[model samples]
Target: MGRKLEENLNFGETESLGIAMEKEDDEIYGIKADEMKKEKRKKKKIKGEEENQNLDFSESKKKKKKKLEESQTIEIPEKKKKKRSKAEGSSEEGNGALEILEEKEKKKKKKKGSGDGNSLENGEQKHGKEREEFEANGAVVSGNDTKESRYAALTSFVESGLPDEVLECCKNFRRPSPIQSHAWPFLLDGRDFIGIAATGSGKTLAFGVPALMHILRKENRKTSKRAVPLCLVLSPTRELAQQIADVLCDAGKPCGLKSVCLYGGTSKGPQISALKSGVDIVIGTPGRLKDLIEMGICCLKEVSFVVLDEADRMLDMGFEQEVRSILSQTSSARQMVMFSATWPLAVHQLAQEFMDPNPVKVVVGSEDLAANHDVMQIVEVLEDRARNDRLVALLEKYHNSQRNRVLVFVLYKKEAARVETMLQKKGWKVVSVHGDKAQHDRTKALSLFKEGKCPLMIATDVASRGLDIPDVEVVINYSFPLTAEDYVHRIGRTGRAGKKGVAHTFFMQENKGLAGELVNVLREAGQIVPASLMKFGTHVKKKESKLYGAHFKEIAADAPKSTKITFNNSDDED
Candidate 1:
């Protein structure tokens, strides 16, 4: 484990930390060791310290304090799903695009040959046994079956005039993930794009490289600016924007680009001064950036490259109007890029409204795919009452790796509070994030969690969207998501940036819709769809019902009032 993470663990969830030998790039993976004594000592040492530090935290917040009750064991129920509505033909669009997709599928098939059937039959599980045998026999599959075995060759080798140094950084990044492979060419060509891919597939660098290149080229051409940010990246939340800003700083430093971030809740006077000092790139959540723009503190007229980091998230957070309003102020002759992990109907409609004709539409991964192969998927079939018992048991069983961090997601703010408290009392260092927490507290909690002061966190869907924390070992969905797309974002939190991880979902009575969709998407992505989620098997459904609301969690629970929010990358962190 990194010293930074270890030193920050005040409530040390004791484990066999000594056995966690590092790997290449300072990675770690090890077999679980059995021990309980160390955990108890560490928990006792940290409990009084943490409780004293935040004695008034809950009272200070808007929500009432939670009173713990006697623990109860929840029961698991058999799954009931709508029938797999036949082997429906691929829902190909009537336009010429479907033909292109068809051609791409053909090419994909030719590349794979035999395992395609086995892959299609049961996803990663079917291949597991055979793969183990193959490995035992020293047989390897090449071509498209490989992660970085480039489905498409690098084209438009250079775009936005990035410096040689910036390009060199990627040369050592091991492999170009699907998103990077698709977006790099278009970005290098200085063309606009609507890049769609799952999280952790190198999406940061897809846009980061182009931005860096754009700045370096500009500097080479003596095209430096002191006032306006040349590139503007937006997201829906501050945490996500902050994470994006980190990526830009890391990758863009090799080039000559300097960046800045602007977001809400912080005092704006300093941000105005930062803007006056000038920056080449600005990554920020849309709300605060817009405030600065309205104040004439931040202008976009000279911005050459505009990126909507998580377009779907912006729309989901209720920022469509604000984003459009900001876009209207920018120069019309600009390269516009929109990226989303899941392309929703609203996002598609937004793309049509903004992007130029036939603008590069590069798509990768399954529609609701989780992260890469390194991330395992599991499902727990249990009722609401038994959930706490199962979660505790599972955590206890798996709490051997101190280097590992666990993120547990719940649907309701109340449930989030409950879960966090339960875990914290159980000798696990835990924190939580929901809209109810003040911005300062939220920031501190995120910082603490990131620093590993708390290795376990109970988060809402808000954390699922775009926050990029590295080295996470697992993401547990304490409650199932309302849509298949949400499920993708939830699990995508783990197995990030080529690290090995797992996603576990606990299913119950109200989670039928989500559980069903999750199974299909997992199957399509060549991931393991847990039998617990499919105990009832697939059943045919007569028709599809209109989605009742934007998100079931948001609609069902009262948290923050949903405002029209514009989400861009983090310029505040710059």
Candidate 2:
């Protein structure tokens, strides 16, 4: 009876092992469509063999179940015997075998479960094709249109509660710009967003209004003992920071919100004094903001809203670490917003770190680097060294009208000053802006340009992104920009406020890389593209470079190498 019980238990284990093997085979049943069609005749012969195997499998399963039931009956008597002799060697050995078998089955089941999870993850990756398309064309939502409908309702600035002063201030009164229309709904609802818009498409007001509204909503909350600001806006350049602060003050004053602008240049005394008194908003460059925070003068722990305007520019300027440190000091629950003209991989990574998992993404223009459609693009093919003569002739023609505000863009700081001197020698009233200029001079230069005292302004790329001077007539690229995106932004300085303007870009043989992108912009805006530019455009095979554009200035032969340092240790008393 004991031998019969042992045989029955072994037979039952063998049948269970066969069942597990058949289940694994079922998992490998996928057939490639093309391969199956080629092997259809061969498969027909195999089908008969497979049917016979299935019949045998069914019969074996039935016999196995019957054996299992019989084994259970035999095990009942064995359990009685084991109870009588629980400490016997044979009984202990039998129990040990059963325990080993159970552990092996558990491991097999675990392996199958893990395999399913891996397959599920791969399926999810395959499903992200639509998401890529939606991001590229700002058309559909990520499977939900609730937010899309809300954004669609605010096509006009009047729909969103803009103060009468702000409404009157807007050059586009009848309808909101593309960025404004898409970003208002999310910002007004206090949701996080990453907005991408062209340079002159009114991004300041897109976030400025919401910052005011958010400050007003939290007006009654008690602040810390120090005069901590409630809202903070960080920009890459001092001029841009001041421009943003001025816009915020104009729109937020009606709601009793005070804004203070802090930057590196100029006296910190006035900024500290203003912050000593309570202010609702603080707008400044990242460097000055970091200085104030380290001195315990500026407290951000109580800030309820924060905006990183021109985020891509900030990253390129090597302020990403400082920006992250400032963000860390702010309240984690704060409403965060970032705006950049181009969405690079670095910007995407920054958004992922700070924003919510599903933050609202608002893309106003084309997904790629694009110029404003309202601006007409024109390309002039010329040699690199002869661009100045062409610019002089073009300026001579456009300088006749007093309303013609011509902005000339150059590549370097020295180039800006040289051009200013050359233009001044020709009896043209020109103002130049670059990084080497003092803050006071920069302010004075901007003032003269805005007042139309200096009709033509020569500037570096610093003035490309965020200076809002009205009635700019013509933009001449005296020196070609390093990339097509910079070219787009330089031209955006003109053709603003729903008015038509012209952009003249000088293309050299080295600038053939930009021809493709420049041609696309021209074709999209319904301008006449020259045949040379169209031919050059064919060389653009893929997307433009991330940090630098197509062209980079080569290092001069006399440039000093900082990698090797020489120490002069001789002490000579003269």
Best TM-score goes to which candidate?
A: 2
TM match of model 1 to true structure: 0.64
lDDT string for model 1 (17-94, tens) is: 232221111221232333333442353354344455344322322121111110100111212111111122342222
User: Which segments of candidate 2 are over 4 A away from where they belong?
Assistant: 1-152, 155-178, 219-226, 401-403, 531-537, 541-574
lDDT of 2 by residue, 355-429 (tens): 754455555544455567778778888886787788888987877664578999999999999889988898777
Q: Give the range of the ten consecutive residues with the poorest summed lDDT in model 1.
A: 65-74
Evaluate model 2: give its lDDT: 0.71
Best prediction by lDDT: 2
Each model's lDDT: 0.64, 0.71
Backbone clash pairs in model 2 (N, Cα, C under 3 Å; residues 3+ apart or in different chains), count: 1
User: Alpha carbon lDDT of residue 570, candidate 2?
Assistant: 75
TM-score of each: 0.64, 0.67
As a whole number from 0 to 100, the lDDT of residue 563 in candidate 2 is 51
